[model samples]
Target: MDYDSVRTVDTAVADALIGERERQEETLAMIASENHVSEAVLEAQGSVLTNKYAEGYPGERYYAGCAYADEIEQLAIDRATELWGAEHVNVQPHSGTQANQAVYHAMLDPGDKILSLELTHGGHLSHGHPANFTGQMYTVEQYEVDPETGRIDYDGLAELAESFGPDIIVSGYSAYPRAVDWERIQAAADAVDAYHLADIAHITGLVAAGVHPSPVGIADFVTGSTHKTIRAGRGGIVMCDAEYADEIDQAVFPGGQGGPLMHNVAGKAVGFKEALTPEFEAYAQAVVDNAETLGETLVDHGLSLVSGGTDTHLVLVDLRDSHPDLSGGDAEDALTEAGIILNGNTVPGETRSPFDPSGIRAGTAGLTTRGFDGAAMEEVGDLIYRVVDNHDDEAVIEEVGERVLELCADHPLYAE
Candidate 1:
């Protein structure tokens, strides 16, 4: 991951790059939304294709020198189709947020009703959080998980859809822990005459590996990021039935973006190809198993998990019961000091600000990418709990920090 070529002209940037690589090499990346991509995907993302300006779909670009662009984009689409079985796939959207934007442009008008999960309730900002454009431009209503179960309240969502008369309903989530019932949500949308848009941005690889149920055939529109669980560098994709293909394409290009990042598309192609391997399935399964182990470890140490456990790659820990005086932000800072990287999150029925909420969210995707197994994750879970439980103890922080470095070194990333 050294930048020797860039170091020739830009020593400053090269220093920052080297520092970031060393940081990743030394710490635990427990952030749910982040993952390490393969060197092949990295190479493709930095390929010469970045200089191209492919403004449209394959073989139909506005530019003349796009034959290579067409070839790479089609391969991305083909591999993605084989992975998720979406009748139509558009890899042009710049991110998962932009992918959602394309769906809205294609299927919704300004001021259309959008019924989605609340931001503090495991939903993403693009799903109608007030700070996002979706909230300002659209009529937005939100649903929440059951306080008792910490799982999506399907009946409540259905009733809300019926009452709100939404034009669209969004499913999938960013911080949720349990497996989703996409069919039930689709039925709710159907009952309300609303389109179902499943944003599987965080679980794309799990779905592709069949570790999680897919929303491709059930939802009216399906969108995801390329890097979360799939390790496809960084990009977004929109998929739908053939009938909505052209609408999605147009929405993505003239509607939401101009020139496609051809290099990112190449990265997506390479990563999708990697995901198709049989070994990827084992990797995906290990991710879930590791999460389960981590969750159990926390619970065993008297930390409370939001969903009681996890069926996905991440877990949300509601710290109020075990450490009422400690804020999630404090816990986050303490863990960071201990070389564990994660984020403060708002739990359901949050009584704290988003900045210093009542919960911490962590994931095993990055650790699993570094080849962490059940035992390794259990130790990680122990270290995380120790840091959170004794957040103020400098001695504990120092000890955990050393252990984290040892773990990182044991499971070396990007080893030459």
Candidate 2:
């Protein structure tokens, strides 16, 4: 973790790099969309591939001296294909949002209708929030969860699909905590003669490890991040049937982005190879188990959980019932000060602004990757509840922060 080479060139940047590593070592990363990548992935991403310009897919590059680039990118595509069982895989979208953009670009025309989950109800901005390009470029309609259950109202979504007649239906989520019935969503798409884009950005590892149901063979297209649930460094992936292969490939390359981040592709290749090991399967299951333990512990402390629990790596907690006066923003700031890093998220039936929402979201991917089991996760949950319950008290925050440092020392990250 020493940035000696960087130090020789510029001490300022080197210090920031070293300090960032030390920060991760001390704090817990419980944010649902984040996880720790392996040292192998780190090295791969920091490799010399960054200097190359591979403007196209493997075997068809626009630049010379791309033989190695072709090899690495091909490896990444192949590994992703094997991982998700897709007829086609593109490993060069740079981000999950771009991967999604490629799909929209390939099949959709301007002003086409898109039906997706409402953002505050566990959806993403890429799913057509007014602030994003998708909203401006297309006609969008949103569905929501069953207010009483805190889960997706599949029947309601299907009904909406029928009425909206969307060109493409978007499934998957950012803050939702339940297992998605991919077939149900696909059926809705089929009934409307629409394409279905299942964005499994948050649950990529869970789906690949068989801990969560996959949308690959069922849905028309699947997109995700190489990080998050997976140990990949930082990149995006798109999977589709053979019929749409060329269209997707074109959309991802010149249509969306100019050049692929070869170092990131190398990272994806290495991380995907690591994910194929038996150890990763155990790790993925542990992520879900740890989330369940955390949720149970929170419930025991009188917290209300969305969907009452989780079937994935993250859980969404509605703080309204337990601490009506406490804003999620205040709770998040206090938790960060206490070395527990998670986000204040909007709940399904949110009654407050998105910025200072009514809930907090936490995940177990980072902790489980650091070797946290059910018992440890429960204790972490206890610590979280303590902080939320006593957010105004600096003494309690300080005590919990000390315990957090002790726990981090016990479960060190990037120790290699």
Candidate 3:
């Protein structure tokens, strides 16, 4: 990953780029929203397509000189269609947030009612957090998980829908660990004569690989980030039935953004092609297996896992019971110093601020991409528990750092 040309032009930027590559190579990436893209995807994202700007969809661009752009964009749309089995696909949203924004713009009015999960309870900002545009524009009514079980309370959601009478219901989450029952959410939306937008931003790859149930056929609209679990370059996608295809396309292009990132479209094409293979299916399953192992290991060490365990690639650990004095921020800092990376997240019933929450969320997607297995994840879990348990101990941190380095050596991220 040497940036020879970049070094010749600007040494400082090149050095930072190389430094980032080295950082990824040496450390663990357990952030549930992150993943390691394949070299092919990297190359595609860095290709000459970045020089072009296609203002519209394929064969109907508002600008000339978009032949290759059309080709890449169409390939991405086709591959996404095949993977999700959606009748229509739009691969032009710059990120998942934008993908979601497009859905709102296409189907919602400024003050329309939106019923979604609460942010602290596993919802995303785009779902309707006040800080985001979605919250400011829409009248949002939030639902919560069953505090005791740490899972979505579908019965409560139906009741909430009846009372709120929302125009649309948003499902999918950022930190939740269990598989969602799309049918249940869809039924709620149906009873209220509302639309359903399922944002699978965190589980795009799992859905693509069939490791998780897909919402393409059930939800009125489905959106996701291409990079998180999909290993595609950074981008977003929207899918729906053919009836709403034109409205979605117009909303994404003219309403939300202009000039799609063609290079990222190419990357999505390549990554989606890679995901279609049998090996990718096995990899997705392994990711879930690793998370299960990590969660069980943490439980064995007497830590509290929200929802008891995970059915996906992440486990949310509430630290209040196990390490009352240590904040999630403290654990994050200690783990990063020890070469193991993850995020401090808010649990379902968070008692602290989001900045220094009471929970840590660890994921297995990046590790599985780098060839990590259940046993490796178990060891990683132990390392995390040690660091979180002894966050202030420099000696413990150094020892854990050494073991993490050894683990990184065993599983190299990108081949030379």
Candidate 4:
């Protein structure tokens, strides 16, 4: 993985690149939205297609030299179609946020009402947070998970929808660990004649492998990140019925972005190809199994898990009950120092600031990609607890760091 060409041109940049690779190899990646793409996917993303300007969809590019770009983009669309069974798939949004942006651009007028989950209750900013364009452009209303159970209250959401009469309802989440009820959400949207956009950015691969219930057929529009559980590198996709295909295409191009990132499209093609295999199905299942084990291990150590447990590849630990004085940010810092990388996240009914919330979110998608099993994840859970329990103890952190190095060595990632 040496950046020899980069080193020849700029040694400083090369050093940083090599350092990042080392960093991934040394630590555990438990951030719910992060994952490692395969080397083949990496090669495709770093290819010469990056130089091409494919501003339009296949067979209709504004640029002249787009024959190969068309082929790659079409391949990505085809593979994504097979993976999710969508009538239309747009692989051009630069990120998941942009994917959501395209849907909004295609369907909603300015000040159109949006009903979505609250950001602190496991929802994403693109859903309706004030900082994002969706919030500014739309009339945003938010719902929440039941504070007592840490799960979405579908009945409550239905009441909110009936009262608000929103134009769209956004499902799917960033930190929520339980499976989403797309049908329930869709019903609510249907009652109000509202559109439903399910942002499956965190569980794209799980849905693709049938490990999680897919929202493709149920929701009016579905969007996801290519690099999370899917391992398709950095990009976003929008999927919907053929009826809305042209609107989505236009929205993603002239409406939001200019030229497509053809190299990332190539990466999507290759990674989606990889995901269509039996092995990938097994990996997706293992990811969930590992997460369950991790959650159980953490519970055994007296930590609190949101919703009691998880049925997906991530777990949310609310530190409020276990360590009332310790903030999630402090736990995150200690875990990082101990070579286990995860993020501090907000839980339902959060009382603290977003920067230093009450929960830490961990996922097994990256670890499972590196061939980690339930046993390995259980040990990882133990290691995490050690740091959380003794965050300020220098000796404990040093010991946990050494154990993390051992685990990293045992399950090496991106090995040459």
What C-alpha lDDT values do all the predictions have? 0.95, 0.94, 0.94, 0.95
Report the poorest 10 consecutive residues by lDDT, candidate 4: 407-416
For 1-416, candidate 2 gives per-residue lDDT tens digits of 89999999999999999999988999999999999999999999999999999898787889999999999888888888878899999999999999999999999999999999999899999999999999999999999999999889999989999999999999999999999999999999999999999999999999999999999999999999999998896989999999999999999989999999999999999999999889999999999999999999999999999899999999999999999999889999999999999999999889999999999999999999989899889999999999999999999999999999999999999764
Residue 167, candidate 1: Cα error in Å is: 0.4
Task: Give me the overall lDDT of model 2.
Answer: 0.94
Pairs with steric clashes in candidate 1: none
Worst 10 residues of 2 by lDDT: 75-84
* Model 3 agreement with the true structure over 151-252: per-residue lDDT tens digits: 999999999999999999999999999999999999999999999999999999999999899999999999999998988878999999999999999999
Please give, for residues 258-319, the per-residue lDDT of candidate 4 as tens digits.
99899999999999999999999999999999999999999999999999999999999999
Cα lDDT of model 1 by residue, 121-197, tens digit? 99999999889999988999999999999999999999999899999999999989999999999999999899999
Which stretches of model 2 miss by more than 4 angstroms? Answer: none
lDDT of 4: 0.95
Please provide TM-scores, in order, for all candidate models, with all chains considered together: 0.99, 0.99, 0.99, 0.99
Tell me the deviation in Å of residue 124 in model 4: 0.4
lDDT comparing candidate 3 with the true structure: 0.94
lDDT of 2 at 5: 98
